[model samples]
Target: MADDAQGATTPVLPPERRTAGQEHVPGNVLVSIGALLLGMLLAALDQTIVSTALPTIVSDLGGLEHLSWVVTAYMLAATAATPLWGKLGDQYGRKRLFQAAIVIFLIGSALCGLAQNMPELIGFRALQGLGGGGLMVLSMAIVGDLVPPRDRGRYQGLFGAVFGATSVLGPLLGGLFTEHLSWRWVFYINLPVGAVALVVIATVLRLPPKRTRHVIDYLGTFLIASVATCLVLVASLGGTTWDWGSPQIIGLAVLGAVLTVVFVMVERRAAEPVLPLKLFRIRTFTLSAVISFIVGFAMFGAMTFLPTFLQVVHGISPTMSGVHMLPMVIGLLLASTASGQIVSRTGRWKVFPIAGTGVTALGLLLLAHLDEHSSTTEMSGFFFVFGLGLGLVMQVLVLIVQNAVGYEDLGVATSGATFFRSIGASFGVAVFGSVFSNRLADQLTDAFRGVRLPSGVSADSLAADPRGIQSLPSSLRPDVLHAYASAITDVFLYAAPVAVVGFVLAWFLREDRLRASVTTPDVTETLASNPVERTSYDEVCRALSVLGSREGRREIYRTITERAGYDLRPATSWLLLRIKRYGSVEPAVLAERGPVPLTVIIEAARQVEERHLATRAGLDLSLTPQGEEVAERLSRAREDSLAQLLGDWWGPDRPTDLVQLVKELNGELCGSEREQPYDGGPAQRFA
Candidate 1:
């Protein structure tokens, strides 16, 4: 039954039991979660799997010069599409859009497998990225629809595991296909997995349709897309395809700045903005976005060069380089899983971000000290520290952002956090790529300054082909290896300060408490429709909290009377409501448990009878038919008002949780079983 403001009819089910989606059944949850994980796996695995096959792709397509574009195309497209997909899902239904993403992804995958050249492959990968962005953003949005906020940590951690597992598996599978089968299999593999995901979502997942009329913000979309595209190109192509100081890069940079100003202006005025400017007003949301961007910048920037160091300086094969990166992956998985359980059990999260980012800074500092002779154990430990820090920080930021906003803005908030991270990654890769190239060129030139070279061979030739260093005189190998090591170390040295900035930002994050329930879009809309009733409910919570038992009982009566237009006094209304909520009660029992005196209880009962609100049958008192209707109206009004006021602090069952908290507090006040103090220490600072 729907909650009515008039309180004319009351559903037998309590407010806590009702939510936007279907009732939480074990079978249904498993089915829905399973489908979502499959979709996530498909998206994450693609990012890494192609890395191992890039050399083979370059060889087959004869585009040795255009190799970076293969990855750049995908990253740019995904980054640009993320916000649009998120806003669209909020406006329309997510299921159809989600399914459409899968279909588009599968089509891109199939076409990519059939590509005959580098241009075709790059074009197809861009298409795949467009779909891949939706798969990621929509999957998170759908999970918000399926799970409540307090329990979302466990699921987010599991998704982190999917990313971790694919990080390890992607390169191995990519290598195997490139060596034994074919490089095309990297793209072909997604086709089958995506199909399975499609089937699962179609059969098992159910979501409510969008009923509200949406004003699509087409102008905002154009401006935001333009900003994202220009900024990403400036990052991706600058210092590589075009000089950083050249007209092409300069023009893109200027264009990006101009579009950003325009986008912000448009969002402030749009009725339904793609990314609401108001969200930045929330302290946690803004702080988390900043921290996420910094982490992405340092993490991805450092990661891009690790394999190069292993290959050129440490002399490891492509497959072994992947294996060598396992410490970070293992550390990420363990920390992510453990932190998730702790947050769910304790409901404290501030410490994770604070400590995690500090650890990240320390890890990067240690990595900056590495040289050609650094031990394997030392390198592994540094990688592990960085990964552990990431695991703790990344998932929690998403969780914090989701909880800060109402259901109406949940998708936009999640996407905004993701968008910043992606942009940071792009910037880190481009800036560091330039640094590595320049530093290596300088070091290689210096290393070969006085050395005699083979006829027609330059230092650049030996730098490009490491195998040529083997053919060089034994005396020169050390110098060349030292140059490669120093250049790579320079990359991490640059990243360490960036990670330190992230650590500093973590202190500013406001530790807002996580809510127990995911606020569904419907609840937000309901409150929006009755803004005045929402204010009344907020007043009821404050008034109820401080009032004595008798006063609190009377306030409850007053709240119901005001909403329902009833004229009953506290005693009569309270007596009537007691019967309605708790069913038939004997007069002796009512007197024993009464907040007022026994005389007051007896007098209230008599008044209720005189008003024909209830009747006496033997020792048991019950509401009459007319009394039942009045009681139902009172109950509905009370519930609706309270729900609007305290929804943020509520769990899946707002009424149930609220009642339980009150009872527990009352018991403690009376010196019953004392609740254990939370041992979170500094972590509990927010509370």
Candidate 2:
């Protein structure tokens, strides 16, 4: 289900549930998971690590006009490549593809570190984004291959934590490296970490070979990529590198429009469209996409410039700039976490995006008021308000989309939401860059009109090297700083209207009853760590697993026993299910598998034997003939109970794959010794 190119309409089991030639032991699974996490960290960190370093990088590399491309190139490549990687992994095996992605990322990272010019760094960053896309998609998909659906929730939080940690750490680390070490170390840092992951994956990761037929949608993918590229080029280069009406910019705009039409036409006929055009017909999805784009535009665009504002306008070190950005990060984290929790508890969600966008606009307006004399406290307050607004909206967009679509469109809708946000991010940076460059050029020219007497100190040089301002004549320094402050603040001033549009659109979103599967806060999806390339069945399983975990471990067996209509003790039912799954269970082996004491295991074994549900022979318990019948009934009951959690999804016409998934999950859930019930508690202890 996780590997399914389409949604649950298809009939592929999730990777971990597939029949394995050799089972992965716990230790091996742990080590493999570590490697995958490291890979994910590498991809996630790169998203933010370069922000604080961008000013220094531009100073050293000398193309201030092209600064946004460094971030834009990576985002564009990653967004375009994400779906392709998931589909390719589905067609071929994932292990080799995962390894290949790591190698490509490392190679790109190395080249990025070695880049001597802005163009070279931008090119290398795109190469890294190509691999980074795979790392983001496949790492999450691979988790499905390593752990059973019943246990997946336990690890999902870890992936979310990785993204959360990187969001804070990336900027700080980038600042430290740039201020203390060379800025080149920002790219070079991926080497040792990626190498460890590469080695660990090669040595420890193993999976059974599996393949499926898929229409790759190569044409649709290409058209979309081309369209994005042209549009971004137009945005980033227009009015800065070239006039907006120049032949080159006009050509790109026309080409982008044509490609977009072609993309829509192609998607109409493609066996599996890169992004299904049919999704637009769903009003909720369409509105969510628009709002998501706006949110990305405001959030990432603001983030890109804040560090520059701090370093240039405030005359702060890169490291201090990173530290100063913490208020926004904290506000974002707090608001997202709280909003998610509130939605999960109340099932109400429409208010968040509206409030978020409103606050975002207010924050942007406040930011526009910042000048060279703005206090740190005032700047931090504005940043916090902006982040708070973003946090309120970011996590809910995906959840609402998931609830809005039917089972058939689940996977595509989720990915589609993420895709638009990424595209918006790319556009945001480029548009912001275009605006900043044009404004800065004009402002710098005006400020230095007749006062410049230094031989080499011109407006162009000041724009290229912000660090050179320290050496400027005292009389000229204030004007230069004010020019930078206004240019950056004007970016936020212009962006506030975009946020207002989002606020208006947010009102149009018809709130739907949240699905039980979506109500549980999936930190991975909410945090945007895992690209949810999963079917409806897979998505449900992950959510239910997390829900079940939250319901308390000891109580799960009891609930299952009651739901199965069993009068037997929870421990007896668990033992019978275990024996039914494995054909035979030894008390000692059962004890070794979990924290359940030998005495509890023996007691459960004795209870089953007394009930004639099992027969003991040579310290191993096997089901009796009557026991077999009861066990089969119990298994069906367990599967039915699991199915009941799916709500309307468990209809009479449900797919065979879903039925199979439920049965597989039932076996795994019951087989987990760690979750075994201790009905009598400490009183039953033999020791």
Taking all chains together, each candidate's TM-score versus the true structure is 0.67, 0.89
C-alpha lDDT of candidate 1 relative to the true structure: 0.65
Instruction: Candidate 2: give the clashing pairs.
Output: 1-13, 1-14
User: Candidate 1, which ten residues in sequence have the lowest lDDT sum?
Assistant: 524-533
lDDT of 2 at 602: 82
Q: How many backbone clashes does candidate 2 have?
A: 2
Q: How would you encode candidate 2's per-residue C-alpha lDDT over 128-210 as one tens digit per residue?
A: 99999899889988887777666676676678899889888888999999999999999999999999999999888986666
Residue 400 lDDT, candidate 2, scale 0-100: 92
Clashes (backbone N, CA, C under 3 Å), per candidate, total 2, 2
Off by over 4 Å in 1: 1-36, 51-72, 87-96, 111-122, 140-161, 178-183, 198-213, 339-350, 399-411, 452-477, 510-687
TM-score of candidate 2 on Cα atoms, chains taken together: 0.89
Question: Over 4 Å off in model 2, which ranges?
Answer: 1-27, 450-452, 519-532, 535-537, 552-563, 566-631, 672-687
**lDDT scores for all predictions?**
0.65, 0.81
Residue lDDT tens for model 1, 1-687: 001111211122223333444353234676778888888788787877776676567656754335545665676677677656766786778888899999989999999999999889989998998888788767766765665432243454456567667877876776677667898999998988899999989888887664335687889877876786786677656765688899999999999999899899998999978778999999888888888777767766665667667656887665666677778767765676566557655768888888878887887777778788988888899889988887777657666776687655655676577667766666666566667666777898999898787775667665445556667777878998898788778877887787788788888887777654322111111100000011111222222222212223346566667788888776666666667644555555555433345676787788888888888767667798999998778766655554443456444644553554344222211110111112223222110
